[model samples]
Target: MSEFRKCARTAEAAMRSVFPATPLQLNAHLSARFDADIWLKREDLTPVRSYKLRGAFNAMRKLRVSAPDQTIFVCASAGNHAQGVAYMCKHFDVQGVIFMPVTTPQQKIFKTQVFGGDNVEIRLVGDYFDDTLAAAQTYCSEAGAAFLSPFDDEDVIEGQASVAVEISNQLGSAPDHIILPVGGGGLSAGVRSFFGHSTHYTLVEPEGGMSLAAALETGAPVSLAHVDGFVDGAAVARIGDKTFARLSDMNLSDVLAASEDRICATMLEMLNVEGIVLEPAGALAVDALVDVADQIRGKTVVCVTSGGNFDFERLPEVKERAQRYSGVKKYFILRMPQRPGALRDFLETLGPEDDIARFEYLKKSARNFGSVLIGIETSSPQNFEALFRRIEQAGMTYTDITNDETLGQFVL
Candidate 1:
């Protein structure tokens, strides 16, 4: 075996003492839909509900062996990483200081606290993650604690490689392709290194956080100017330097960007159809299947479902985004005459499958006409075409603001 694979095997062997191997099961739903042998490496089912625990446990185990006196560990994260570190700290009986942004949801903070118990100190630091990270590093330097990076450390990378080790053993052979979700590139780098061209690979990222693609183009990691934080799990602004070094040579075409709205649709499908709850980042690999359907057809493919840390509170937003993306829901501003029958005229134009979701008057005081905001939900996308025709035939003027980001933000 190659040196990297050997180290990965060692890590995998060590992981059994901490937690059982995550399941690798053939997904009949995905197999039938894609016309391929679709296997899911269920990293989402880990103790901390993410592949992150693997790296955290491995890194801390090796660290304690090498430097017995270094009992204090520090890390900064808003979600899965924090929970992973907390769980490992408790398991190892080590003291850890975890820094998280103040804006982190109470649900996440509560879970982290429950995982770490008394072994981890939770610090609610700055408003932003970057600021929280800075605070953690500063505290580490002042207190002489060892700072643990979420993805930049060599030991952590080695730990993540354990995922690949498990996959190979579980599958009994290399698959035709492996699809991985890239955040800071740790998981992708580790898995890619272990396989080393033995199989084809597809790297996926949230469209708003395509750090790997940007790094490949610039020849170095560069911070994105703006990032949509909807996919908070994989919405990294920049790829980690160490992780990027291993993945830098990958073909740019292999990197796929999934849209935030479209990802919501995938999340809903997995929940409604497959009965799986996936966080935004956790769903990346599966969501990417749409883009690679042709390439993976009739081949054995594995998709690593990285995490399942979804908050039930976000379900409404997820549903809304899914409906919007599928064109089953839309918002529009209509110009209506300032008369009693004018409102009834518009109401009479609705098709049988159309339902009004939202209605508000924007210009109630107009002398001749009033502007009304209307949200319509229909059974199918074609329903909108028919609805629009009815509105036009009635001589009512309207602007479809469902896709107008600016207007949607302000009104919808």
Candidate 2:
């Protein structure tokens, strides 16, 4: 075996001491739908419900041997990495301090605590993740603690390569195509390095957090000026410097940027149809398949359903986004007459399946017309065009605010 393969195997062996290998199972629903044999490297089923544990375990194992007296480890993360480090701390009976942004959800904080038990200390600081990361690094330097990076370190990348090692062994061959969701590029770098020259690869990144794309364009890692944090798991502002070095030569054509709302549709479809619970980033690879259908058809494809640390509270938001992306829902600013029966006349245009999700009169804009914010959802996307057509014929002026960012942010 190559040096990297040996390193990955060693990491895999260490992981077995903590938890069993995650399953590699064929997904018939996806296979039949895409006309491809789809296998999911179900890293979501791991003890930490993410592949992050593999990196954490491997990094700690290597560090423990070299610096046994270094019992304190430190890390910064808003979600999965924090939990992974905390879990590893508890498993190894070591102390760790995890710094997280204040914006991190309570559910994530609770999970990190549960995983760490008494071995980890949670520090809430900073509003943005970058600020928290800086704080953690400073704390590590001052406290003499070994900082455990989530993905940027060489050991962490090598450890994450274990996923590819397992897939190669289980599948008996490199897959035709392996779809990877790019965050800091650690997992993608690990998987690509393991496959060597065998497998065709595609990288999927969230549109708002296309760090990989930015890195590829700039020929080096660059922080994004703006990022949409909707897909919290993989929405990184910058690709890891070390990991991106390995991925810099990859073809730009092989990378895809999935819209946040479109990703939501994939998440809900998998949940309601396949009974699979996937965090937003987890669904990126699967959703990207839609864009690359021609390339993967009739071939054996593996998409890493990377994590499932989805908090249930976000389900409503997910559903709303999915509905809008699928064209079955919309919000509108209707200019209604101030006279009575105007609301009734507008309501008459509704199809049987159309439901008023939001209805509120903002204020009277003029003596003759009042501005009303209306949100309508229907069983089919086609209903909106018909509804709008009727509105036009009836001389009812309206503007669809569904795709209007500034307006939607303020009102919806």
Top model by TM-score, which number?
1
Q: Which prediction has the highest lDDT against the true structure?
A: 1
Looking at model 1, residue 30 earns an lDDT score of: 96
337-406 per-residue lDDT for model 1 (tens digits): 8887998999999999999999998555648988899999999999999999999999899999988998
- Tell me the TM-score of model 2: 0.98
For residue 171, model 1's alpha carbon misses the true position, in angstroms, by: 0.5
Taking the tens digit of each residue's C-alpha lDDT, what string does model 2 give over 168-282? Answer: 8899999999999999988999999889879999999999999999989989999999999999889999999999988999999999999999999999988988898999999
Model 1 Cα displacement at 367 (Å)? 1.8
Cand. 1 TM to true fold: 0.99
Candidate 1 backbone collisions, by pair: none
List runs of model 1 lying over 4 Å from the truth. Answer: none
